[model samples]
Target: MTLLYEPERFKDESRTKRSKRQLLLTKAEEIFRTQGIASTSMIDIAKIAGVERRTLYNYYNNKEEMAIDIQIEYLRNYGATVEFKINHDLDYTKQLESYCDTYIKRFLNNKNYIIFITQFDYHFRHFSMDDNLDRYHKIMKDRNMTNNPAMEIIALICKQKELNVDDQLIRKFFFTLHHCILGVAQRVIFRESVFIEEQDYSSEDIQILIPILVNGIVSTLPSYQK
Candidate 1:
């Protein structure tokens, strides 16, 4: 049976088609996980996805493009699963705590993603990519992050928690979070920093470590006007 086209269901045809393409990317990922990329072929993904080789080609020019697509999907999944959480309904400290706790947990769960992500053909293309592709996406996201519904709520938090704080620091703090993730991923890939499997580590250790890091930064920065 086709994974996407259920026997009985109706929805937006365009959305269904988009999902069908995404399903192919997931199938491609599973194949990579099971057989390893070196042994996997485009034919293997096509067979796994129940799509013809020609159909796969329509979405991606070849395996390199397909690999990039799978990495993109992985990053999107992580963002959806682990990205920031801000609750305007809650008071500032409580909401910040919730967001910090959730983001750290998400990061902890994603420890192994760096290993696979580094293998993608063009995962770091943002800094290296031609302006035509990367710039547009960055600009769109930057605008959204500053003005989106979520940020509007976060703005409320800023007003409540750091009533006298500079708004630029609020933005810079979020940028620091992004930098931390990139730093962590880099160390994970290089096997440079503290690691879970090294000499001694546990989930509890990480739980403790994250809160210390979060609260330390929040406290020392003097950003919290209260």
Candidate 2:
């Protein structure tokens, strides 16, 4: 059976419904990222999107619904970029380089995005920005189009013989990867809070730092099960 997708479902073109959905989503993202989810109201997004308050609700049930949709879109967008780069590059280090560069660049350059994350507190509430993580996980049960961006890249690295790692071990490696990246960034950029007590780490140092961290974590995990 052939799959069918309306031409209007794609990114560009002239379609009011699709366009409004995109506009509403984009506005919600901006509001959430700048003012934070808890602080942002549907009316705020409506004002930003140039739509009526009721129109915002017409698109989303509430702030949580909008937050889930926007956050899910961000994660999927990040994953798609990573997937394209991973599939294009053969060298494992090259893939890792692509992954690391994209990850750091996107987050570090976006200040309002950073403020939202820090304000929402991702560590304490991983589900804060996203209440639909379980839904996403279910979609990714067979490694669907939606999976964590960082994990997607690691899967590509594991495919190469030089990386010499098994698929089963990548999850543990990914957890370490996640915290290492976050910890390094917080240690460098936000020195006023929890980081105030922690030692300072420069971004330059992380280029050398991450490899050591990944290698240690990857090596500690057991080899592929028999």
lDDT of model 1 at residue 109? Answer: 65
The weakest ten consecutive residues by lDDT in model 1 span 1-10
User: What TM-score quantifies how close candidate 2 is to the native fold?
Assistant: 0.60
Over 1-226, each residue of candidate 2 has an lDDT whose tens digit, in order, gives 1112122224464477667777777777777765767777788989988989988777677777666555445444433234334454366555555566566665565434445445445422743544555665554454453365556666655554345565556765666666677666644554334443454544444566556665654454335423
Query: Global lDDT for candidate 1?
Result: 0.54
- 180-220: candidate 1 lDDT, tens digit per residue: 64555544543524565674544434344445545555565
What TM-score do all the candidates reach, one by one?
Answer: 0.58, 0.60
Candidate lDDT (C-alpha), each: 0.54, 0.57
Q: For model 2, what is the error of residue 188's alpha carbon versus the real structure, in angstroms, after optimal superposition?
A: 5.3
Clashes of each: 0, 0
Which one wins on TM-score?
2
